[model samples]
Target: MQFLPQAPTDRHTTLEDLQGIVTGVTMVALSVQFLQAAELITGQIAGLSLVASYPTGLSFGLVFFLLNLPFYVFAILQIGWRFTLRTFLAVALLSALVELMPRAFSLSGVHPGAAAVLAGISAGVGLLVLFRHGATLGGVGILALWLQDRTTLRAGQVQLGFDLVVFTLALFLLPLATVLWSLLGAVILNVIILTNHRRDRYIASS
Candidate 1:
């Protein structure tokens, strides 16, 4: 019987990494638009930022960027400086993009259900792109990827577990129906990563 390669044969070029990071962050920024339009939240630091932003009158970008600051130490210690740097860059870009997108293109009249699904799809694919390029958006993503590398846990599963906690806390802050719709988006995002991001199935290194 034949089997797929279990190891990465080559590293991504510098230019490839650049484009990948840009594309990934852009898609994620787009996802943020959908979430904001519906006032729905997803998982991870991004969701926490939204929750905080709503009541505090803070920009999601500013809150997200600040929330990620402390995680850089954890990311550097756990994943190495190169990965940490890339993650920082990705996070910074996403923060800026989320702010800029709203100014350039506005979204309205989007149903929460459709927004949830669209956010899930875009964010999932975006995160996959970032992961393949050896980067993340920081915070929970950093921990999730580290656990996936060190233990038997899948990154998506670890993230989903974290998501549940975030959602639980969110219940106290957000409307019940809003939280439920947001949960659907989170589930879809994690399911995509759970199914497609196994080391055994995809071995390409950035």
Candidate 2:
């Protein structure tokens, strides 16, 4: 009988990892600032949360935080408790930052097209940072991570599909021009993840 070598355990995140999470989330909050400034939307749960909060008196941060609640089970079960907890922390950090960003900063004359592009790029980089550190922002990502764990599928592909569905729903919630611009952002965002976040590419370090 041939014996297989055991897989090495991943090292726990360090203080630098936590700082990276903060920095990444701050960038995401900056992206959200642009999105709200233009009254535009992108794909993923963030878009859904924006749509849900549009007519209501509730805040975007609250809606976004609540929207992610359902994915914890998948995160914990498939990705492990550490990942789940880190994700929850990331989501909470994103939520707080989204709310705080508007108060701390504002932009004038930001075109919707520019907003979409900037928001997509900023959020993509932000998410990449989280992904590298073994975390996510919850929602479709949790599902993507779980699916990636169980199958040969790449998490980015799974995320792209979910992003498309959310963008389709954006049609009903936003203007045609806004949705079109958002589509561009979604494509950019998905492309970033698909190109950079492959399971085969992001090897674990000791």
Candidate 3:
């Protein structure tokens, strides 16, 4: 008897994939808490929330979650339900996690220089995980992906352009040295995304 070979299939997400998204967003939230404690901001929605929170005395978690709401419609229409739902969950969980992170640990001994670099590393790694899992932390990421699909530009480029605007705002709100370090963190985050998140290289459902 001849045996039949298996047909090609699109790999679906496993339980592990779901868990990774949660873990990744948690890392990102923790990183945001670090940035907040240092009174530094990075870029994109996270940075925007940071800037707003500093002035308004509102919670960054609340601001971040609210800021991401308008983009979910675009996200669903462009990326599909799985991606959108995962993004929503990640964003919501991140919002909650950020609130909890400060209470969970003390940052008194942490230096600004170290906090900035660690924030970048943790954020970059977390975002890398989210991207591979076919999800995002939402906000500008959804807009960037939508714009990239419509234009000749790459998503990374669109994100970087927006990040520059966020950093410029940081200049007014934070000390010059702090903004410079924040820029460094932004660069590290972009380097991670641009280098590792290639579509042709990593094929997964999105």
Candidate 4:
């Protein structure tokens, strides 16, 4: 199977990569701030970061970046060089954004409940944009989506299963009520994709 680079390339390859990198970093930085305030864990790689943030004093961006490194090999082997490069750019962007955004913008108090909903919406919108453009936030999510395409299992189920495990861990670490609320946010995120992320309508119109 062939995978196209999610973002368009320019005459200068460096420029194209730089664009992806910048996008990745910005999205992740905003994402982390939301996550931190909301106490909600996102799907896939971000979820892992949510768990890791507890034991490790490292920032979410650092943990998120390191955790995703192993998956780059999978992206390379399964997807191809173009995809790997795009994923690399995305990963780098997210790492940089998460680390730098807070310094640039001062974010104050947030209501965790509201933050969870807002974070879910923000993440879902950001991810949908990336996916529509032929890019992705690097994680096992890309692999999981591919697997679901090839197999009988649904992509939503795969993601939900992973999320459930992460939330369960969260429940143990935090409070059960928080876990439940976070799941609500996850549900909101998935709903946005399921309804609006389809290409068939756009393709037909075009």
Candidate 5:
């Protein structure tokens, strides 16, 4: 059987990557704000950080950064140094933004449902940007991307599976209603990724 040629992939310029990463991380930081305002947690490392922060009085930024530390080795082994470095920078920027955004402006009276949907959309698009730019926010993101590259699994599906475990653990710590609402946000986020983040359609590289 004859095979068709693959689509051409374009490389992003340094400036393009810089702007894209910044925009992606900023959007994610905004989603964090929404999650916090509603006292709801999504899934993955961010959700784990929120779960850890709520009762411990620890800063989400600190917890997030710390949790991602061990993943660097796995990322380097599974992906590459370039991707790992970009992931590190993205994580650091997000952590700082999560800390600083609140000082600039605070969210108030945000309904849980609104927060869930908004956070899902914001984070979903933000992560898509990061993925296209050859970077991730680290932690589960790195694993998801690696799995998608190495196997037939979609990154979003991998993340959703991990989310199930996170939510299960969350049930022990958070209210049942809160976990369900947060699951809605996670489902939305993953669905966006599953639907849009196709390597076949988006043949760009950074």
Candidate 6:
């Protein structure tokens, strides 16, 4: 039996690997900064990380990593080893970036509305890179796309539904208006993913 290749692209060359790590780190950091600046929440593990960060004083990066651990097992069992490894490495890079961002940059008085827009765009772009690479940042997103393959539901809609639940929980922790901002962020984020992440649009003719 011939086994498939590990990844779509070669994983060698320091520059190529570094590119994925850098892209993942930068985008995840941007998303966290935007979320904190906006005082808003997102969906799935990232939202949970925001919620956990409130009490633990743990960085959102750390929280995000912890929350995604179990999901890696799910990914391995449901998807495959190669996907799981790529996702694990991507999440690790993102988590490290999140922890280091405070030292790298600061957000003093960012307005919620502005932060929402930036955060959405940053996250959308960041995840877009991972998806294009056949890797992921993990969490409900991984499951959403998996389900989309088996069911007739659109992946974006599935992700949106999950985001709703995550933001709904935000209502309890934040003011109603802040939760609204998060919802706006989610909408913008999803729109970017749907419009830009199409296989036909992203894939190059080899």
List clashing residue pairs in candidate 3: none
Model 1: pairs clashing at backbone N, Cα or C within 3 Å: none
TM-score of 5: 0.96
The CA lDDT of each predicted structure is 0.94, 0.82, 0.82, 0.67, 0.94, 0.76
C-alpha TM-scores of all predictions: 0.97, 0.90, 0.88, 0.79, 0.96, 0.85
Give per-model CA RMSD: 1.1, 4.4, 4.6, 6.0, 2.6, 5.7
Off by over 4 Å in 1: 1-3
Please identify which of the two predictions, 1 or 6, would achieve the higher lDDT against the true structure. 1
Writing each residue's lDDT as its tens digit, candidate 2 over 62-164 gives: 9999989989987777768988888899999999988877777688799989999998899888888887777889998888867877888877789888878
Badly placed stretches (over 4 Å) of model 4 are 1-25, 152-154, 202-206
lDDT of 3 by residue, 1-206 (tens): 97554442455457767888988998898788778778888899989988899889999989989999998998888778988998899998998888887777867666778888889889988988887777788987887666766777766677778899988877877889988988888888877777776655665543
**Residue pairs of candidate 6 with colliding backbone atoms:** none
lDDT of prediction 2: 0.82
What's the number of clashes in each of the models? 0, 0, 0, 8, 0, 0
Model 3 segments beyond 4 Å from truth?
1-10, 147-152
Compose the digit string of candidate 1's lDDT tens values, residues 1-206.
99857667878999999999999999899999999999999899999999998899999999999999999999877779999999999999999999889789899999999999999999999999999999999998999889999899999999999999999999998899999999999999999988988888787688
